[model samples]
Structures are given as C-alpha cells and as structure tokens.
Target chain A: MSGVADDTAVVVDQVSKKFRLFHERNQTLKSAVMRRRRIVADDFWAVRNVSFEVPQGETFGLIGRNGSSKSTLLKTLARIYVPDEGRVVMNGRVSSMLEVGSGFHPELSGRENIFLNGSILGLTRKQVTARFDEIVDFSGVETFIDQPVKNYSSGMYVRLGVAVAVHTDPDILIVDEILSVGDGAFIEKSRKKFLEFTGQGRTIILVSHSLPQVREMCHQVAWLDGGRLRAVGPTDEVVAAYGASIEAESS
Target chain B: MAASYARELIATRELLLNLTMREVKGQYRRTALGQLWSIINPLATMLVYTLVFAFIFRAEPPPGDPSGLDLYPLWLMCGLLPWMYVTRVITGGVASITNNAGLITKVYFPRMHLPLSVALSTGITFGVELGVLTIALWIFGGFPLPWLPLVVQAMGVLAMFATGIAMLLAILNVHFRDTQHFVSILLPMWMFLTPIIYPISLVEDAAARAGEWILQVYQLNPMLHIVEVFRALLYDNRLPGAVESLAAIGSASVVFAVGYLVFSRHERRLAELL
Candidate 1:
C-alpha cells in the first residue's frame, strides 16, 4: 500500500515520555508549600526510547494491547505530551483527532459549533464557511445543524465531530481510538475518507486496538509492549508477530 | 515552542476572537434577560452603591472639575466600572485553564489563548458597561465626548493589566485549586482597599490622621492611581496628569510582563498536569 514513493513524513527519533505517579491526591498550594516543594511521586516512563518512521502517504498503525504505551506514543506525535528524552521531528502540518468534540460548546448550535470548532483548529472564518456545506453533507446532520449540540443524539454528536476533524486538511493526522466509537455507516464513511486522505500523498498515524482493522487499513504497523517497540514492519508480518507474542504470553 | 509572543498572538488572533465570542454568546443564552444583564447588573450595583454612600454616608465626592456636574452615581460608576472590569477579568482568567481542562487536554493549542480570550470577553462586558456609564455621564455632565478617547485608552491599560494578572493566576490555579477560592475572597476586599465606593479623599483624610506613611502605603495601591485615572477622565473630564498616566501604565506593563514570563515557563507541561 505504501510503496508508491518514499519520502519521510514523521520520524520518532528515540523519544521517551515520563509520567509521574503521584502519592497524594492533593492539587493545592497549601500542601505543596507545607511539604516544602512537590508531593511524593514515582516516575513512570510511559514510552521508552522508541523510534519509527512513516513514509509520506503511508497509513501507519500502532497496535498493542491495553497499557502497551501505543496511545502515549501517538500523543507524543500529536504534540500533546512533550517527550522528556529525545525528540520527534515531522515534515508536515500535524493535526490530532484525539477526541471528537474537543472545543464544542454545548449550548451552541451545530452550525455555530462548526465555525467555533474550525477556528479552534486554527482555520480562519472564511475557510470554515467555504467548507461549511461539505462538512454538513459529510456528517448527514442537516436537520440538527441549526439546533443546539446538547440536543443532538450521541451518534449525531460524534458524526459531526468526525466531520470537522476530517476536514482539517492536515498533511499528517493522529487518531486515537475514536474510529471504534462511531456507528457502522459513519465508520465506513470515515474509512473511505482515510483512504482518500492517503491517496492525496498525506500521512496518517492511527492508534487502534483492532488488529484486523489495522491490517485492512495500514500498510505498516508498530507493535508496542511495555513502553517499547517490540516489532515494526509490514502490517501482516508485524501483526502476525504480535499475535504470536500474545499467544506465547497467554499460554 | 512559543517562539514569539506577539507572533503567536498574531497567528491566533482569529481563534482568540472566536473563543471570546463563544464566551459572549454562551454567557447570556438560556436566560430571559439575556444580554441586558450586562447593563442591568452594573446599573443595579450603581443603585446599591448610591444608596449606601450618597444616602447613608452622604458622601459627596468633588463635582467634575470642568463639567461642574455633581451626580454621585455617575462619579461612583466612573471608578467602579473599571474596578469591576479588573475583578471579572481576573476571575475569568484564574478559572480559564481549569474550567477548560477538557479542551486543553484533548487539543494542542496555545494555552495562553484561554486566559487571553477570557480577558477579552470580560472586556466586551466591560465595554458595554462603560458605554452605558458614558451615556449617563453625558446626560448629566453635558456630554463627556472630549474625554472619551482617554477613557478608551484607560480601558486598554486596565485590560492589559487585568489580563496579566489573569494569566498568572490561571496557571497558578492549575497548580493550586485554592487560588480561585483565595482570589474570590480577595477581590471584594481588594475593591474596598481600592476606594471604589468612597472617595479617595476619605482615605487621604484617614491617612492624614493616622500618619503620613499611611498615606504613602495607601498611595502604593495601584488601583488607586488606576481608579483615579478613570475618575479623572470620565467623571472629572481632565487629563490623568503625566505622572498618573505613567504610574498606571507602568504597573500594568510590569504585571503583564511577569504574568507572561510565569505563564510561558509552565505552559508546555500544562497538558500533563491538568
């Protein structure tokens, strides 16, 4: 799938992120002051020195079981978490679809949210207006577009969120376990959109728990285990290796 | 990295505008009074303040120097509106980050924009309040059109100052939940310390009686100069003297700079902590 032309889009160069496991639930200054500084905490490295590269136009997938640090790596790529060690370098505009309705105001109408959410994603008002019709059409929530988003059914809310994020028109997109939430029709629509996105020579980094879904979509995959990359290669090979490792552990 | 604050601000100006408008639109929705609350709330404050000082205490602040108008409500508001602006802006700023922890965590944006938009939205409400006060001043004081530009300038200075404080407190509030609670307690007390209700002459007289150093300590209040500046322009219809202007703008700039520095240092780790 990704053998078209080789140009690197994202490079994760030995990046590591450390998360602190706090000993106390205190988030107030009084306790911190009384304690002379910070509360007791143990350092947990969420992701170790894991490195990988995605060629331009490649649909790359990160597959691992729960607590495998796949989502942390994805977040590091999204610029949500600053890597405590090493760095991540990217060659294109990056947008992360971590959550569907990130900046949506509940009281705002869907039509208003389109503009508000678009602006939050750094799109100008004019750009949001131009793509306004396309977004509404894609989401298939024309009737509720003018109604407050709080009134929308759960499916409608997610579908609209997906539409805005998909239309951000980024060179690189970071997705985190969101595709599994939408209805089947919407998920199919999103799948087709990703294919079209890759056809334009853009790159996508998806973090998913579904192995078959990853095999169906991504050309390459990285399997993370306990904060390190256990395997990285073609989708079928790496997924098979990951499957084997799972069997070995279980048996 | 936020390479340049000005550059980042320029880049995200549209987003700032949208966020500010979001606050403005969301604030008054699902209510009967709607946007009218912006005007009514301040007017109500004026009514209570007038009842307390003008009626009970019989506090007669100096008539406007040139306009020769002696309306207590107008003069009180000229000072009180700016005070309220600072208070509201700071509260919005302190809560800006914590309140939007959802948006901040899910998306990677310039976190500075949250407090900034809060200040700006508070500024909008302040602008509406000032407009009504200006209109009232005109009705009683023969139209203060000549001093309107200075009023606008003072608003800008106060806004910059308030936003700086907001930015500082917002990041701090992220670390200390008590910050928001503490600030709510301090603001009303801060208003009393600033001389919004009674005239500065009352404080001057008290200081004169207590000791001259008390006057010095009392004068150290930045809001004193700032409120006086607002009073001088809007109520008294005069320039805020070169020294007053310099003092007001200077303190505001310093607060803003410190706010910027503190906020920038803690910005990157915000997503993790929150």
Candidate 2:
C-alpha cells in the first residue's frame, strides 16, 4: 500500500457518481400520465467517496461482487463519467479494455476494426500502420483479417481486441475481465502479452473476480463491497482478509 | 480556451478522417452499388420528379419560352441538390453521436468530432452531386455563367451555414429524440415553403401588397436566403450584396455557437444517456 502512495500514477480523491434510476421509462403519453409524481425514480450513488491510487509501473487489482462499483471506478478513471463530486487525476494516457470489441463495427472487416480500435485508443494512423502486422500476428487471425468482424467467433473477436489494446502501448491500462473471454491458450498468450506490457514500466489497473489471477498479477489490491472500499493493502493479505470476510458472512 | 479547443480538434484530425471514411464505407458495405448509390439514389428521384411534373403539368417551359431552355430541371436540381444534402446532414447528423454510444461510453476524444464527421461524409456525396450538376449544365448549353466565381463563393457560404445547422441539429437530437421525428416531417414541408418549385417572382406577384413581408419571413429560414444566393450566382451571375450575405453569416454563426455550447455541455453525459 505504501508503494501506491510513493509513485501515484492515478489519484482518486473522494470520488462519487450518482445515477438516476427510472422506475418507468415512460416513452408514451399513456405511460407518462399513469406515472406517479416524482416519476418513480431515485438518486443512487454507484460509487461513493472512493479514494485510491496505483503506483507507477505497478499492477493494482480491484475485487468486488457484482454491482460493487468495480466497473464504475474504472469508468471514472477513463473519464466516461465526470464524478458528481471530487476529482480523478490521471498522470498518463489511459487505455481501457473494459469491453472487448465494444467499438468494433460489425460490418467492417477485422483489418478495418484494428485501425478503428487503434484510433479510438489514441494511436495515430502511422502508429497503427507500423504495428498492424504485429497485432494480426499476435491475435493469430492473420488468415481472417479481411473478413467482417460479424462473422468472427467470440474467441477470435476477443483475441483481436486484446491484440489491438496491448499493441497500443498505453501508459496506464485498465482492463475489466477481458481474460475471462478467451480459451486457455489464448488466455495464456494474453497473459504473456500483459506481462510484457507491465515489464515496459506501464501502470495497470485490473478488475477481476478470480482471486488467484489477482494475487498473481497485482502488487497491491483493494476490496470494494456495496460501493465502499472494504480493505486496501498488499495483495496476499487483502485477498486473505476478503476471502475470510466472505466465508464468515456466508456461514 | 478557444485556442486549446482548436488545437484539440486539429490533433484529432486523423481520427476524424478515419471515422468519416468509416462512416462512408460502412454505410453501403453489403449493398450492391456501394458508393455509386449515393449519386444514383438522388438522380433516380430527380428523374421521377422531372417526368411527373414536366409531362403531367406541362410545367416544363423555361421562364420565358419553352424552347429557350428547360429551366424546370435546372431549378429543381439546384434546390433538390442542396436540399438533399441539407436534409441528409440533418437526419443523419443527429444520430452520429447517439449511434456510436459504445465509442462515446468507452473512449474519450472531442465529442464534436463525431457529428462533424457525419457532416463531412455527407458533404462529400453532395460534392459529387454538384459536379454532376455542373456537367449536366454544360451539356444543356448553360455553359459557364459570368458569375461563376460568385456562384462558387455563395455555395461555400451556404455550405458553412448548412454545417453550422447540422451541428446544432446533431446535438439537439441527442437530448430530445423528438428532433429526429420533427426533422423528418419538417424537411419536406420546408422545401414546399421555400421557392423551390416556383419562382420568387411568382410569390411576389401573388402576394402583391404582402410580398415584401412574406419574402422577409421566408428569408428567416436561412436556407431560403442561401438558395436565393445560389440562384443569383448561378443564373443571374451576381452575388447578393454584403448586407444580405452578412445577415446570413451572422445567423449561421449564432446557430454554430449555440450548438457548440449545447454539445460540449451535455457531451460528458452522452455515454450514460445513450
């Protein structure tokens, strides 16, 4: 945990995000009239007063149950949501693999999506051109690069997404369970590529449900439960504590 | 702040270029004709209109004589060409940001780039139509007008104004989905209200006492003034005076500023809304 304080690649200060939950979407006039006053909605804080930092060139893991603000925190870091309160200051170019193939056009070929994905990740055309062959080779989809992405298998799609993202050489990489998408072999390849990326002195923020993977990759870890941080410290200790807390609750 | 914004836009130029190309290519990907459909669609529509209006109504005569030149096709083409471009930009531009909800939600770039890319892509199709129109005119013996440069300048002015409106509608449609429906209904009605099929002279003659007022109100549409400017340049070989041009420019600039403000303000929330 002290290591996070020393290098501080990403700083989250009292960050909070509030969302309006609409009970009735009320698209039609009939529905609008039937809807009660105040419109059956409430303000919900998806993330509240969350503050943490990842050190430069260190792998940090966030573990939580579903709807525990794990993905929301990554979104806040990506600048997708302007925090309702507090500030999130990131020191370098951030690339998020929150959803693989999220930006890929179905009609476009695998080759086109590479350029499209690369551009979305802030790589210039020249940069994408330079690494195009490497990306295709890494994905092992060189034979199907010219085919439309819609026809590609789910595993192939994830492989291409991972390949493009790793090739971006992002300063801070935020990944959300991307490894869970592919098969064992592809996952092994992806893990190797991720290790190579981290070896180049890049900061990584990973969110995963798999405890062992987290413990293996992360130098430090944070546990979030119900939109609040439960614990933050060295990976092994925090994971042990989190596991114990869960078992104790279930029992 | 403006300088920084301009620099950011410039920095994203390559992204914009690639995105715009993607829009153009992605549009007709599985279709048979692909890009040529851009030209063929409008040309086919024009032919249908020409046959119906010319043959049925016998409204094929030029302004003065039937044999002099068939001004009907030229008039219809002038208005239809620009109107097609404007309507496309309006209808398509609105969905530019909303349609790419995934990109907006996942990544961060200048949000304005999305709508601007749609406008630029549509503008390319419009350019091709314009080229085809020029060729048709030359073949018809309309040749080159004395005010060719002025016509080109006016077209430039109109494009700027159209782009500004496109930007505004794009942003508005994201916030209020009604804008999409409203634009669909509004465009054809707008064409009817403008002096597209008929001449302004006919309006002036019919209105008699209220001619000036009606024309003035019509001028408020901005596109009407743009069309008039286009006609004056291409047909009459003269540009509208500084006063009218300035008024058109001023209105377009205002639309642009308002659109920019709305887009930038709500852009951060687009990922959630979409």
Model 2 chain A weakest lDDT span, ten residues long: A28-37
Per-residue lDDT of model 2, residues A23-130, tens digit only = 766343345556633466799999889888777888999998889999988888888878999888787888888888777888999999999889878899999999
- The alpha-carbon lDDT assigned to residue B136 of candidate 2 equals 71
Residue by residue across B1-274, what tens digits does model 2's lDDT show? 5556668889878888878878887999998888899989888888887787666755532342221345677767766787787788777777777788888887777887887787788878887887787667667755544656765665566665666666677666665566678878988998888766656665666677766787667667777776666555444334566666777677667777766676666777777766
Model 1 lDDT per residue over A178-251, tens place: 89987898899999999999999999999988888998999999999999989898999999999998899999
lDDT by candidate, in order shown: 0.89, 0.78
Off by over 4 Å in 2: A1-6, A27-41, B1-3, B57-70, B145-156, B209-212, B241-244
Error of 1 at B182 (Å): 0.4
Residue ranges of candidate 1 with Cα displaced over 4 Å: A1-6, B1-3
Clashing pairs in 2: none
Lowest summed lDDT window (length 10), candidate 1 chain A: A1-10
lDDT of 2 at B176: 59
lDDT of 1 by residue, B85-153 (tens): 999999989999999989888888888888999888988899888888878888885467888888888
lDDT of 1 at A75: 78
